[model samples]
Every structure is written in C-alpha cells, then in structure tokens.
Target: MVVQESGTPRELEHHLRPSTVKGIDFDQLLEPLAATAHGAANKRPITGVSLNPQIVQPGDVFLAISGAKRHGAEFLDTAIANGAVALITDEAGLNLLAEPASIPVAVVSDVRKIAARAASMVYGTAKNCPELLAVTGTNGKTTTTFMIRAITEALGLHAGLVGTIEMSARGQIIPSVLTTPEATQLHGVLARMNEQEISTVAMEVSSHSLSYGRVDGLQFAVSGYTNLTQDHLDLHGSMEDYFQTKAQLFTSGHSQRAVVMVDDSYGQRLAQNASIPTESLSLDAHTNADWHVVNIAPSVLGHQFTIVHRDGREIHARTGLPGLFNVANAALATVMVLASGVALEQLQEALKQADPLSVSVPGRMQVIGESPVAVVDFAHNSDAIAKALESMRVTGQGRRIIVFGATGDRDKTKRPDMGAVAARHADIVIVTDDDPHGEDPEPIREQVAAGAQAVIDAERAAVQLFNIAPRAKAVEFAVSLAGVQDAILVAGRGHEVSQDVAGIDVELDDRVELANALKLHGFVTIY
Candidate 1:
C-alpha cells in the first residue's frame, strides 16, 4: 500500500509531542496498566510516551502492541536503541523479549486498552483536558467538528480542532494523519492545547479510533452522532458492526451527554439505546425530537433554518455551505454548543452577529469556479455521493456533471453502489482513479463503470459515462464538456494532495486541478 507520512519519522514524533511536558513517575503512570510489574524497572520519571519504535526518544515509555503480522516485541531492540527508557506490552510481547533486557518492562493483558490512559497520565492531559466536544459517524464528522470550532470561536473562545482534514490549536494548523490520532499523539495534542490555554476542543471520533482504544481515556463534554451508512465495510465487515463501534462514543463513560440525529434508523436506534442522557434532533418536525429544524429556505449564503426546541425555545441559523446535509451539520453544531451549557440567548446572538455556521470547511463543498460551477468534495461513499450530487443539481437547462472514482483496497463492495448513485444523480459521470493503494487501477474503474453501465442499460437512462485514468485528465474533460450553466462536481479525495497509485505517490490536488482546468477552458475560476 502507498503509505503517506506527514513527515520523517523523527520529525513526526517530535511534532506529535507537546513542546513542554511535566515528567511523571513511571510507577504512578503504570497504575492504569492493571498488570504486575516485572524486570528491574524503577520508579523513574518519564517525559513522553510513544507507540512507534521508530519515534521513541529518551525518557519515553514505548508501548508494544501485537499486530496481525508480527508482535511489537520484535521491535523492542529498535525502541531501546532509540532511547526508550521503559516498555509496556502484553504477555506475548514480553515473552518475545530477550532475557536480561536493559530497560524496565511492564506486562499487561491488553496493551491497547491502557495505552491512552498511560499516555494521558504521562502528558498530564487526563486532568487538564479542555472542554472536549466530539462527533462520530460515517460522515459529517469533520464538517460538524469544524462548525463546532467556528461557533466556539464566535463566542470569543479559543477553540481547538481535531478531525479528518487537519488539527488546529488556536489557528496553528497541522495536517492530520488520521481522523482521530493514536492515543499517544492524541494525549500529547491535548496537552499542547491545554498549554496554549485553548478552552474548548472539537474533535471527530472515528469508528476505528473508538474500536482501537485511541480515545479510551477521553470523557467528552458533549458527543454527537450524525448518521451511519455503507462505508468502511472492509474494516468493520458489516453495517451493524460499524454502528456498534460508533456507539461506543455515546456511553456515559465516554461522554456526559449526546446530541443524536434521528433521521436514519441507525441514528434512531442509537438515541434510544445510548447509555447516557441523549437529545434527539430531526429535520422532520413530526418526529417528536428534542430539537427540530423548520423554515428551511435557500438564501444568498445557503439555506436559512430555525432550530426549535421541544421546550418552546427557538434559534434562527444559516449555513453558507449548500445542501440539506450541511443544514443538519449546522444544527448539530448549534445544539452541541447549547448542550455544553451555552445559553440559548447568547448562542442566538453569536449566530446573528458572527454567523459561525457560515464558516467554510476545507475541501467540503469547496467551490473552485463560478461559471460551470465546479466543486471539490470528499464524497467517496454511496450515501455521500447521492447527497453531494443532489445538492449540486442544476436548474433549467443546466446539467449535473460528476467526476469521481472509488478508493482502492477499501470496501470494494461499495464501488458499484457509488457508481449507481452517480448514474442516478448526474447527467454525465466520469470515473477516474482515486488512491489506488496497492490495487490495480483499471479493475477498480471497470467495477464502477460496470455499475453505471448496468443502470444505463436496465432503465434506458440517458446518462453519459466515461472511464478516464489519472484524475487530472478526467477533471479537464469534465470542464471541457460542461456548459456555462452546468455544475461540475469533482468528488472523492476532496482536500487530499496526493494520489496513491500502486505504492507510488502521484501529486494531485482536486482544487488546483479543477481551477487549472476551468482557466484552461476559459471559465471563470474562483479561489
């Protein structure tokens, strides 16, 4: 697979840790390990924590977890060579270690479970963590977190963000490697935010993070659920498994309260069964939710809507981003802040004055052109593709044109579904390569194209389909074929800067490619 790194191993290691750390007693930090201590390990102070042996540094406790291919004890020598002072691992890892090891060792039954707690103790984040607000689901996690950060900022609070696109602490942005970072990096980032005096944090909690104990030690002030759909089946194996993984974030252990969207069955089930005080939100006024959206009308910015509470409270809001889904995201953000104890009157004032919901999220319905209106979005899955295309529908003579492709080596079952969604929504569909990591590009394209072709043949649909490789050419072709009144959507890999093709990184940014193509086609380009 094409492995993308944010930086060199050493640089990334340094970047993940906070600049300043208060050393903690190793024995005290090991209290949460829940295992007997072995070896000649003393109660020395530890300055940092890391799970990666390549990034281990002096005074750091290295966590060795077993992997599918190899045990982490295999890298014990490398971690020690890089200056790891102590080791935390399972019995399997301890058994693999050589006799008479130099450093101290602690053996746990499950390393992943206690890794976050240990890191939190070492980084001093468990007690000093900022007001944490989190969102988890198949989609809308990133946008909702961004919206939460925006609203928090509008209220004159310094807010930090951790999500799919990037992580930020008081406006210092760092490109993120995962939707939710590993426990070591997560605690370190939280420590840094605390050091910077950031009062609130909006983070996207992914299913993988929840399932893997990445967020084990975090107790969110408020957590939210958007919706679950057919994405990441490769990881979870089934939709039910994916739902359960996301459900972990809403329990009393993980969050104090919850704001759940009951528009879908999964959401409905979650809200009903969540082991915490939960507030239900729905676009349907008749759904009997704690919060309901009404008076949705298109505006110059986007759609203006009103959030109505069951207790006769009302807040008017608007989002600059298009689509009904964005409206849901904005409403979710508003209620999450309200749940965090922001007064309704104060939040309404902030919405009226600052319009925090109007903030633009990177690569999410990001507009690159005014004429032949072009957009770059991260809509790789079937549900997201349908929503994106529906939102970009043209009026009168304008046609909806879409250029997208399936991500390789990920949920191969969704490829055909994504194509079918495109064929049903767009008048023209151009299938291109998107991150063909370790998988042949052509076979992936054929599967997607086959789905589109099936729809065209079965229903006699008047949809035009094209299979193009090397995404840049596909974008160019879409722009060339579009009319001034048409709208073109370059979907999938929204803000990603590089394409993974058979273990090689081919540089490509959708916004830049789309903007360049629009200019080449004599169309008006937007920033």
Candidate 2:
C-alpha cells in the first residue's frame, strides 16, 4: 500500500553536480573520501562504491568519511590503487587533493544527504525499490527494523534489512559495522536490493544519519519511532538535541506516514507535531493513541498482548521475545505493517503465528548458556541499562550479578548515573572496560565506581565494588565469581567482538568467554 506519487525518476547523476556544495553540508553531510591523492584515477562516471581503497574497483566512487576517531579520506592512495573513478569529498580533503589525480573530484555541499541522494539516483531511487520503511529512535530501533523485515518476508515479500546487527537480502550476508551507513553506501545497498527484486527495505535511522544528512533525498513510505532515551549525548550535546535529530525523520518531509510509539512524552509530542497523519501506539493506557495495546501480559515464555486501532480494529498479538519494552517494539512493527497497508487480519495472523525469527542481534540481550541465566546485553546508556537490569531481575529466579563498564571518551556524565542504577539494582557489581578509546582506563573505572559508590550504603560499598580495567579480564573475573544459582549480567559490550584500547581493536566477547568459563567449571547440562 505504498502512497502513489506522480514524479519523475530520481537520478543519482542529476544530483552529483559540482555547483551545489554548501559548507555546512560539507562539514556535517558529506562522507570524506578514504583515498589519498597519491594514486587517484581520472574523474569518470562511478558505477560502484567502496569505503576501503584496496577493495575499490575501477570506475567506482571512493567515499572518504571522517569517522569517530579519524578521517576516512586519509587512505586516498589505497583507493586510487584499486581503481577509483571519482571522489566525493569535503573541504578538509581539498588539501589532500592539492595536486590533480586521474579522477574527477566533486566537492559536495553536504556529503551525507547528497551522497545518499546521489547513490539513489545512480543506483535507482524509490521508484526502483518496492517500498522503503525507516525506523528511528534511541533504543530498539535495530530490533524493530529487523522485526519489520522479518514480518515482511514472512508475509511473502522479498525484504532487505539495514541496521546495527547486519545487512542481508534473500541470499547474501554482509556484516554491519555501523547502525546507519553513509549516503553512498545506503543508496548502493538499496540499489543492490532493487537488483535482488527485494520488494521492501526496513532500516534503522540513527540520529547521526538525520543530522549528518546520511539519509537524505529518498522518500520513505512508512517511517516509525521506537522511543527516545539518554544515549548519544556526546554527539547531540543534550536530550533536546537528540530529540530534534530523531524528529527530523518524521518532519523533514522524507516520509509519507509517521508511526510513533507514544509511550513516552517524546513520542506523544512527535505525534501531535508531525506534518503527516501519525499512527500512534501505546504500551500503557495514557497515550490514547491511534494504535493502542490493551490487555498486556508478560510471562517467561513471551508476551501476550492485544492491539487496538482507532477504528475498533483489534489484533491479538504474541511474540517469543521477553520484556514489556519489546511489546512496544512489536506494536511498533505491527503499526508499520498496517501503515504499509497490510490487512489487519494478516497482521494478526503474522503476530500470532510468525516463526521464531533466528535473528542474533548481538548485544540486545544475548543469553550465555548456563543455569541462573548469564546474559550479555548492549545497554550502555542510563535508560537502557536500567531497562536491561530490571528485565534481567524480573525474568530470573535468583540473585543478579551485574558486570558493566562505561566507555572512556564518551559522555562522562552518564557514568555515575549508570553506576548508581547498577549499585541499587544488582547484588554484585563488576565494573569493567568498554572501548576506552584514548582515555585512561583508571579514570573511567573511577567514574563508574564513583557512581556505584554514590548509591550504595557506605558500609556495604567496599564488599560489593570490584574493578577490572580490561574488558576480558573483568568478564573472566566476574564469570569466576558467579555460581549456578546467581545470574551474571555482562552489559555494555553486548554483541561486539572487539574492544578498542589505545586506538587498536582487541578481540573480546562476553558470550565466548562465558561459555568457556562454564565448561571450565565442569558444568554439563543438555538443557
């Protein structure tokens, strides 16, 4: 049920012109090239895309983006060596391109959106795609995006997904490195999806992508919001800034119908303020939303819930996933399908009988094999941490041993808050490492320790507190401390396979370590 629009085909070649580059666009939007001028080829029509220079094929465009710690364009020589035809860059990369290379260099006004639009045009825009739905918010965005993709495919639609965990089509698997990719990469992905005859795409829309113009130019048939929380304060500067970025997806005129979860105030505000007609969902009764969940019940098996639309349409839904939070996620997915014009009866059947999706959303809430339920979840922010800890507490039959760490260089303010929550909730607190980046491990440990200490009674603080600066060592020590009757929670580095220490990514996984530790302790159970 895509909203039919009368328009010309959106073209990539049409938007890649040199005349439209803006400074702010260059600073915030464009992806800087990873290639250096040392080996750049002559400017030509790019038929392919690559971030890495070595893998760049001839006649392909090389995108140089400034990443979390370094500029991507610093690898221009490598890009040129592999046969890059053109370059999309920002002002800073001009110095690198001082001497002309073989390729045509186009300075973009805003790299993010421009690149996305360019890729769409080159790869084939919304016209080529069956339909596109972008899911945005602070938490559960990745899960909801994947859920929608799963439901779509389950209903016999060929679906493609792009989110934090991975990217996939009917038959190929590509590991996901970013929650949302750059404009060119995104467009290229859609292009590939079009080639695969994928009728739909469900993707996560990060605040960074919206603010940086990473998702510009393409129109979304249905765009949905999960919930906003206290994450990414380091980049957005404040909660208001974060909300504004998320709001852009609904209001920036890219989406047709907005599906928002009005469980929180932010979602309520978005529903009331959005330009398009919004489908609002609620986990609790306060929202009085367009799409509402009633008779909600949670159990160890999963969630049994009912969805009520404003027109008296009802859907009795169930999901294998646990927690009340996931109900909101499921409801959001249901509404996205409804918004896309799937029949209510179909939505109900899909909800009730959809096969248990084999999605390994790395850190969402990964269960480590053992009794007492050792779990690893990617709950770094205060809101997510609180939710993860509480979910673990409610689901388990024994005392909880929570192990976590705050990143070294991120929003330092959240450290104490996270510590306070962990201290008040968990029976045991094992403070550990999570991507210290350039910051010293000790200070990060101290900050989290300070947080936990602030909430704990002074008399018991010393006994409950333990610090292990390196993540693997911290996990090892924590795992050793747990017994079969106690649940050990390894939070923060949920699905990640590496730890960034002193600028190098070192291998580490909570699941792998926990498995070995369980086997080492000589615990055997087929269950």
Candidate 3:
C-alpha cells in the first residue's frame, strides 16, 4: 500500500482486530514445535496472552519465558490462579506446573521470538494503523521521534509517538518505564494507536529491545540510525557486539528502508552494510552522501541549518534546541519524513514554518534556567556528557560547571569515562548520585570521582571537584557557586521524575531542584 497523504485514509479498516482468535487452540498452535509436552492434547483454546504473571487475566495464555533471575515458568501457579486458560512456554516451564491438567500447557522452544507475533494474532493489528517508523541509536532516538511527530502534525496529520518519555496517542499520554516496551505491550500500544486514527508513528527502537526479542516480528515501513557511542557495554559485553545488535534493525525483517546518519564510523559502516535500500545523511561537507548539511548557525535560542539532497533540493531548518549536534538530529528527522512517503517539498515547507525547538524532548538538553544558565540532559555516557558540556559551553558566554553522575548496576565501566569528560570540560565538577539500583551509591560515586581526580591531577587542571551523594544538595551547591556568566549543567536524569536509590525511586527532579536552588539564592533566570 502506498503511504497515505495528510488527511487522507490509505485504506479502510478491514477488521477492527487484525486477527480472528475466537478460540485459538493451544495444542494446534504448538503442534509444529519439537518441544515435548505431556498434556499437549488436553490443552484448551486461549483468548489472550501475557508474559507477566502479575497481569494475567482470565483465558489468557501465560507465556513463561526463561530469564536471568528465575525462569518465568516459576510463576506458573501464579498465572493459573489468575485465570490463565493455557500456558505457552518451553519444556522447562511446562515442567514447573505441578498439576498440568489444571491449565493447558503448550511448549515453544523460543518464547521471545514468537511473543510479538502471538500478540498480533490475539489483539489484532490496529485498523489503518500508521506506517511504522523506527529510530535506533545511542542518543537522539527520543528527540528524533518527537521531531517526526512535530513534522507530521504540522502537515495536518495525527501522529503518535512511543519512546523513553511516554507512549502517546488519542489525546492520552502514559509515563514510560522502559525506552522500548516488551513485545506484548509494544504491539498493544501500536494497536491502540491504530484505533486512535493515528496515520503515522515514530518509535524509539533500543539496542536492548532488538537483542532481547522485544521488537521481534514487527514490521517497519522505515527505520533510522542516529549514532552509536560507548554505552551499554555492560549489557552487550563489547562495543562490536553492541554495534551488531544495533545493525540488526537495518535488515529487511525489522525495517523496509533505512535512513542512516553517516557522521560516525558505526553509521558509515551501517550505511554500507545495510541489507535494505538505504539513504546516507551527513553533517560534514567533504563527505559523499545522499543528504548533506552545509551550514550551521548556533545562537542562545538554538541553531539554524541548511540541508541539500542529492536531487539538488536545498531546505532551511531551525531548532531552538542548543548545540550543533541538533543540526544532525534535525537533518536525520527531515529525511525520515521523506522516506515515509511524505513529499520532500511538503516536508521542506513544514520545516520552514514549524518551531523545531518547540518539539524538544524533555530531559534532553532541557534548559531550565538562563541567567547562570541551568540545563538538564540525559547524557549519562562519556561521549554524550562531553558533547552536552561542549554544547552548553558554546550556548552562553563564560565558564561551565557540570553536575553529573553515573548509574549503578548498569554499564559500570562508563562511570569513570563520564567523570573524566566532566573534569576536562567543566571549570567545576559536581559528582552526584544518578540511579543506584540495588548497589551502594558510594562505590559508583567513588569510581566516577576517581576518574575526575585522575584527569584533574594529570593536567594539574584548576577544575574543583565535589562529591555530593544527594542529587538535590548537589544542584543546590552548583547553583550557589554559579555566576551570571556561567552555565550549570545537571546531567544523567533529564526527564526522570525520581532517583533510583537502592532499588527505591526517590522523588527528585533536577529541574525542580535547580529552580528551587536558584530561587533560594535570590537569583532570577530568563526561563
């Protein structure tokens, strides 16, 4: 089917639900698999499916997938009591059910691989669901998705967005716990968007999602790559493995076409090795690319740039989002729109009229104050922290002071790298607690502080370091030290509302705390 134009329906809704599952038999569906099941013949039909035992309802098939903590099959009794009509899991999970006859058990070897498609069968795909556009990268995924939504809406189309911040559609927004939801919830969200008459959607596809089978079996009309940096090594083990996992989205099964930003080596290789039709975008003038950005002007209000395609079409774009990196992000979003079948001319016109800064994703280079400039961003990685600090330095005149921290139990190796970046870039560095999930907050801070101390002592840099465990106090201290010409950057948790400390979500907002600190110091900001 051709991509639908703004205000035009591409196709009529065939069925409200994508599939007919009046009473899908469990045994029949599992018959093709080699999994051994003693009660295969006795399994009954199921009306729905769920992986989490906590949310299982009547007639739902509780999918007991194995996991690191404990096999999901361990929760079989919990699922059965919650009205699960049948169980679809591996041979191990089937063995967990003490009384297999209480509920039908059908074994599947690979639960993660089949969970998404199973959802597609039960809930049915949304009617006239918007063409799926997936964006994957180390950063900019959230910003780009929000950008696509802005550009799409500017064209008089209702577009839905699913990302780290929220899952929004039908005039409703829900806070998100994960960057990308698991397969069942992800498809359910997509179907919900379809029902809401959203003709287009932009979803942030995470590397973890790709590797864990979260995005398995979903179709994407177009997918995109922003850039890969050194983060998530804890989960993937090595940078090469991380890159390969991100590269999987560019293949035919996950996406139909790819729009890749070739500014980095990983991106360049991705463009070269992409299995599907690909479009190359670049910010550098000397590089050979299909989409080229030639000019960038950064101001206190943000930046403006120009983009030229291989067809000789040049378009002007502007963003209130500070930093030259945003120019790359805006350019990436521009091509994504074109790849989705929007007329390039239409997109160009929208860029001309739309306020790109107004489309900013929260906690992403979020400016909370101006005089003694205060900024908050989700720059937890070393590379991202460096870029964010540099972006803030150039935005306003004067010395830079950074308030940042590394999370616990996730990619511990990046902690020192982040500290070193802050030490080198900021005149003053405040090391604070980020998200110390289950681990003692002290060790994480010490590792990061050691990196900062190392850099400071190595160069005999005048950068002063303060180890502050309480994030709120850290913001206050930074604000107390800031002058009118200085910028205070609070990194790590951009839009996050709470601090994850020892497995508990402690309520803390950098923006709120920063604002309060500024107010306490009798300082007024341009914000």
Q: Using lDDT as the measure, which candidate wins?
A: 1
Residues 1-527, candidate 1, lDDT per residue (tens digit)? Answer: 21333666667666566787778877777776676778886666898888889888778998999989998888989888988888888888888876856888888898888889888888888788899999988889989999999999899998999988888876577779899999989998898888888999999999999988999888999999999999888889999999988998888889999999999999999999999999999998778689999999997637999999889899999998978999999999999999999999999999999989989887898889867778999998999999988888475799999999998899998898888889999999999999999999999999999998888888647899999988999999999999888999999988899999889889999999999999998988876
- Poorly placed runs, candidate 3 (over 4 Å): 1-45, 126-128, 393-397, 525-527
Give TM-scores for every candidate, taking all chains together and pairing residue i with residue i.
Answer: 0.96, 0.84, 0.91
Predictions in order: lDDT: 0.89, 0.72, 0.80
Q: Candidate 3: deviation at residue 429, Å? A: 0.7
lDDT measured at residue 166 in model 2 versus the true structure, 0 to 100: 69
Q: Model 1, which residues run further than 4 Å from truth?
A: 1-7
lDDT of 3 by residue, 134-251 (tens): 9999988888899888888888898888889877764556656588887877776677677677889889999889988888768788898999999888889999999999999998
lDDT of 2 by residue, 381-472 (tens): 87777777676642444667788989978888989888888887787888988889999988888899888887786534544778875666
Pairing residues by index, what is the TM-score of model 2?
0.84
Q: Which ten residues in a row have the lowest lDDT in candidate 2?
A: 14-23
